[model samples]
Target chain A: MQYQATVTIEQKAGMLDPEGTTAKRALGHLGYEVSSVKTAKLYEIVLEAESADIAQQKVDEMCQKLIANPIVHNYTIELKELN
Target chain B: MKIAIIQFGGTNCDLDVLHVLKDVLGLDAETVWYKQEDLTGFDGVVVPGGFSYGDYLRAGAIAARTPIMDSVKKLAAEGKPVLGICNGFQVLTEARLLEGALTTNEYPKFRCHWTNLRVEAVDTPFTSKFKKGELIRMPIAHMEGKFYAEEKTLAELDEKEQVVFRYVDGNGKVMDSANPNGSLENIAGIVNTSRNILGLMPHPERASESILGSDDGLRVFESMADYITENF
Candidate 1:
């Protein structure tokens, strides 16, 4: 089966988010009343898998090894079956 | 001493380190490509600064995972002195050889200037030449040089006295204004728990000569040489 994994990686909580703050300040300048903002990277990975659970497990390993640095970032993985 | 200077693609400071070790310090230095596996017969290793792998994904992230890192890790495990300067520091952190991470500067800009650093601990091989609390000046050029670690890790590092240097002013005060990248606790450099691996943001090689404006950086190399002479 074909599965698509959507991995979302972002700075860990209480970590300084410079890019987020800059974007938030820019939004404020543009009249958006946002108090804060946090930025994240989303990766769409396509691969073959027996099931969504297996795909998710594989992606979790990927995140630990490469996709996310545990020191400063947290990540979430979502897997969807594809035709 | 035979030192291996690891050179990954985009490593611009390899030659600078080469000049400092081979030319200035009169040590035998070789530029080892990142793909090379063996690190035998080298007394020490220096990972020079530069945009390794074009700083893709994250600064030093890609380069840290290369094959040569395994050998570097092995070298470090053997208690060999492994120094990582600037981007090399990032690689050490990314490789988990050192704790913490170097993030984008608080100002979100590339900083290139002379930075004053206070040697916090001299027990380590890298800073052994400097007296405790001595101030040294070196140049730092990087977009992601802000040192960051979680509160628990920071506390542990402090407790273990793993922090080797802190950014300071001429008066030896660690003020926020003196912190170019807003590193946590003004940390400019740190060593691992074992104290064999040292990583710092400033370019000591750039300051190894009096003609280069200051010779303060030579003290670090000298300290490493002394340690090698004493132990190895």
Candidate 2:
């Protein structure tokens, strides 16, 4: 079976988010009243697995190995079986 | 003595490093591709600056996982000197060869300019030629050069005296204005716990020659050479 996985990587809370701060500051310069903005990277991957459980496990391994840095980033993984 | 300058696809500073090592320091240096799995016969290794893989997925993250890093790690474990500059510094952090991460600059800019640094410790092989508290100037060109580490990590590094260089004013005082990228504690360079590996945001190769402004960076290479002669 083919499974599609999406991983969202985000900076940990309390860590400095320069990209978010810059976006918020830029919005303020444009007269918007946004308090803040946070940025993240989303990765969509398709792979072969026996079941959704296996797919999820694979995606989790991917996240732990490369997609996220435990020191600065947190990641969430979503998996779906493809027909 | 032979040294290897690990070259990734987007590495632009490999030649600069070769020039400094071969021409300036009189050492035999060769550029090794990232795919080469073995790093035997090299007494030292340098991960030169440049956007590896176009800085994709985060600067240095992908490059750090390449096969060559395994050999680099093995060599580092053997107590061989390894130096990483600029983007190479990012790779070192991503490889977990060094602690901390280099995040985006506080102002989120790709700053390229000469900055003054104070030598914090001289006991390490990388800075043995530098006098304690010596101030020198070097160029830094990177967007994500702000070094960030947890409080505990910072404390441990401080306690171990592993910090090698700190951004400072010409007068050697670490002022906020002198910090180009808002690195924690103005740290510009640091050594591993073993002190054999060094990673720094500054480009020592760019300053090895007198005509390129200041020749202060030469001492770093000189120190490494002296270390190889005495220890290896």
Candidate 3:
């Protein structure tokens, strides 16, 4: 069976981020009063697994191995078993 | 001495990095596609500066998720040397091979100019060519080069002397105003706990030639060569 997993990674808040600042400024120019903005990347993966536990394990491995940086970016894996 | 420099779809500085390794340092080097999985027989690896994935989504964010990065990570885990410059630094942070994250410049602008840096730590193979407290000049061009880490982590890095470089003024003085990206502690570079992997926001390969106004950058690549020759 195959499972779908979504991983989201973002820069930690209070850390200096020039890209987010530029986006926030642009948004303000468009009449948005957002004081700050954070940037993140979302990745969806399709993988095969025998059980939910195994699926979660595979997803975690993916994140640590590639999907997310363990130091700054926090990641949460959402596993949906696909029949 | 085979060295592999990873080349992503949008990487811009692979050639320059290749030049530094092959021409300046007189080492055997080649550019490897990011999609390639094998990294055997290479003494060192470099993730050169450039807008990988066109800096889309975020700098280094997309490239970090590339298929080749897994091989880079595995090589780094085995204590092989990996150096990331500018955009490469962003990729390293995103990949978590090195500590901290690089944010946008403090000025909130894409800055392109010569940056002064102080050697904060010299124990790593990357900085072994320089003396402690030595100041070096290198070019920095990026919109997102600010480095940040948690306070405790920062303290730990200080204790371990892993902080490799910090921004400084022309007079060789460390000051907040000289900081181009408002990086915490004016950090310009860092290394992993083992010190084999290094990530710096400045481009050393760009400054390896005298016509570029400084050859200080050559020492960095040379030092790595020396380290590999002596230790490995």
Candidate 4:
């Protein structure tokens, strides 16, 4: 089966995010009442796997090993079966 | 005194370190390509700074996973002194050889200037020549140089005396004004628990000679060289 894994990585809470801070400041300038903003990287990985469960495991390992830095970033993996 | 300077794609400071090691310090230094598997011929390893893999994904992510880093890891495991500078430091953290990660500065600017770093520990082979509380000046040029670790790990690092250098002012006072990147506890560099691996943002090779401003950074290289000879 073919699966598409969408991986979202972002800076962990309590850690400063410069880009998010900048965006929030900019939103304030635009007259929007924004309390906070956070930035994240979303990766859509398409791969072949035996099942959705296997795909989820593979994507999880990928996030741990390479896609996301475990020290400062949190990641979420969503798998969708493809034709 | 042969040292292996690992060079990955986009490693611009490899030759700068080479010049410091081979010409300035007069040590046998060579730039090893990122594909090389064996580093048995070298006594120490220096991971010079630059945007390896064009800073793809993260500053040092790609380079840390390259083949040569395994060889560098082997050398490090044998109790050899391994020093990482700037992007090299990023590589080390990404490789899990060192604790903490380098991220964008608090101000999110590419900082290029001189930094006054106080030696917090002298136990590491890289800082054996410097006195504790002594300040050294070195130039740092990078976009992402903020050192980040979880609170628990930060406390452990402090407990283990692994914090080697902290950013300080000209008067040697630790304050927020002196912290260029807003690192935790004003840390500019750190050594691992074993004290054999040291990582920092400053370009020590760029400050090796009097002509390059201060010779303060030279002591780091000198100390590493001295450590290799005495122990191995």
Candidate 5:
């Protein structure tokens, strides 16, 4: 079986988001009804795991070692199993 | 007079920093790799600038956890002087040796140029060579230099005179537009609450030589020498 994990990283609140600000302003003028928006990096990984527990452990290691910087970006991981 | 400069893999400024300390200031300094666990008998420790771990997850994130930082933190806690420049500043903040965090520049570009800095306090060992309100020129090169801290923490730093340097204009006035990184209160450098650790975005070593334009940075290094002589 193969599992897919996705990780998203976002800037903390009150931290300036230059990229988000620019994007939000542009989206507003385009009539997208975007009030506030923040930018984040996304990573998706596919790996083989016998069980969900093992898959989660590998995903956690990936987040800690490479996917996200715990110091600034907080990450949320989503996992889906494919049989 | 032996100074230890921590050498992380991506630390580009370690050699230049050593040159400034040895050749410019005539001090004995050596580079210590990040894996070393001990930093004994060193007068001071410097964390030079570079994108450690290729700035992989975040600037200074990976390097902060290196074994060398444990000893650096201990030295800083003991009131020994530690200076972090550019990416080194980010490393210090990540290691919790200093307060606040650095985000990307407001311009969203990798800014590299000389900028004006006003010395906000001369009370700490880091800025003793300069008088309060003196304006100095230094080069800043970084994509993430905007410093952010909680409002209460910022207020406390102001009250304690720990906000050491701020970005300014040629007229010696601090203006938001002149703030290259949009740092809180235009902060460019600061000392820890204990006043032993200093972190700043500007490259003082780059300005130590007259040929580089201004030698104002020599004062910063010289000030450290003065502080060491006076105290130790």
Candidate 6:
């Protein structure tokens, strides 16, 4: 089966989000009242797997190993089976 | 003694580091491609700065997982001296060979300029030639040079004295204005627990010649040569 997985990686709660802060500041400059903004990276991957569970595990491993830094990032994985 | 300058697709600083090591320091240095999984015969390794893989998916993230990093890790574990500069520093953190992560700068811009750094830990092989508290100038070129670590990791770095350099003013005053990338505590460089591995945001290779501005950075490689002679 072919599964499509999307991984969203974001800076952990206490980690500094410079891009988010910059965007928030820009929004404030445009006269929009915005308190905070967080930034994240989304990776959409299509791979072969036996099941959705296996696909999720594979993407999770990718996030743990390369896509995300455990020290500063928290990643969420979404998987869908391709027809 | 032979040193290997790890080269990736976008590693533009390999020649500069090679020049400093071969011409300036009088050490035999070779540029090793990332595909070559062996670092045998190289006594030391220097991961020079450059946007490896075009900084895709975050700076240094892709290059950090290349096969050569396994050899680099072996050297790091065996107490061989390894220095990671600029983008190389990012790769080191991404590889988990060094603590902390180099994220986008506070203002989120690609900063490239000479910076003053105060030597904090002289015990590292890379900084052995530098005096304690000596201020040196080096160029830093990166968008994501801001180093961030957890509070506990920061505390441990302090306790272990792993911090090697901190951005500072010409007068050696540690101030926020001197911090180019808003690194935590103005840290510019750090070493691993064994003090064999070093990662810094500045480009010492760019500062090695006085004609280029200052020869202050020449000492960094010189120290490595001395270390290799004494240890290996």
Minimal lDDT window, size 10, model 5 chain B: B223-232
Runs in model 1 with CA error above 4 Å?
A: none
> Alpha-carbon interface RMSD of model 1?
0.9
Across A1-83, the per-residue lDDT of candidate 5 in tens digits comes to 79998888887665677888999989989989777889998888899998889999999997876566554567888899876
Candidate 2 matches the true fold with a TM-score of: 0.97
Quote model 1's TM-score for chain B: 0.98
Q: What clash count goes with each model?
A: 0, 0, 3, 0, 0, 0
Of the two candidates 1 and 6, the one with more favorable lDDT, higher being better, is: 1
RMSD of each: 1.1, 1.1, 4.0, 1.0, 3.3, 1.4
Model 2, A4-82: lDDT tens digits are: 9989999988888888888898999999989779999999999999889999999898887788888899998888878
TM-scores for chain B, listed for all candidates: 0.98, 0.99, 0.97, 0.98, 0.98, 0.98
What DockQ results do all the predictions give, each relative to the true complex? 0.78, 0.80, 0.37, 0.91, 0.42, 0.81
Per-residue C-alpha lDDT of model 4 across residues A39-79, encoded as one tens digit per residue? 99999999999989999999999989899998889999888
* Interface residue Cα RMSD of candidate 6 after superposition: 1.2
- lDDT per residue, candidate 1, B209-230, as tens digits? 9999999999998898888878
Worst 10 residues of 3 chain A by lDDT: A10-19
Off by over 4 Å in 3: A1-83
lDDT of 6 by residue, B18-137 (tens): 998888878899999999999988899999999999999889999999989999999888788999999999999999899999988887788889999999988888888999999889
TM-score of each: 0.97, 0.97, 0.80, 0.98, 0.86, 0.96
Ranking by lDDT: 2, 1, 4, 6, 5, 3
| Candidate 4 lDDT over residue span B16-126, tens digit each | 999998888888889999887789889999999999999999999999998888888888889999999999999999999999999899999999999998999998899
Clashes of 3: 3
Q: For residue B60, what is the lDDT in candidate 1?
A: 93
TM-score of chain A of each: 0.95, 0.93, 0.86, 0.96, 0.85, 0.95
Q: Pick out the ten consecutive residues of candidate 2 chain B with the lowest summed lDDT.
A: B223-232
Once fitted onto the true fold, the runs of candidate 6 whose alpha carbons sit more than 4 angstroms away are A29-31
Candidate 2 lDDT over residue span B32-105, tens digit each: 99888899899899999999999888899999999999999999999999999999999999999999999989
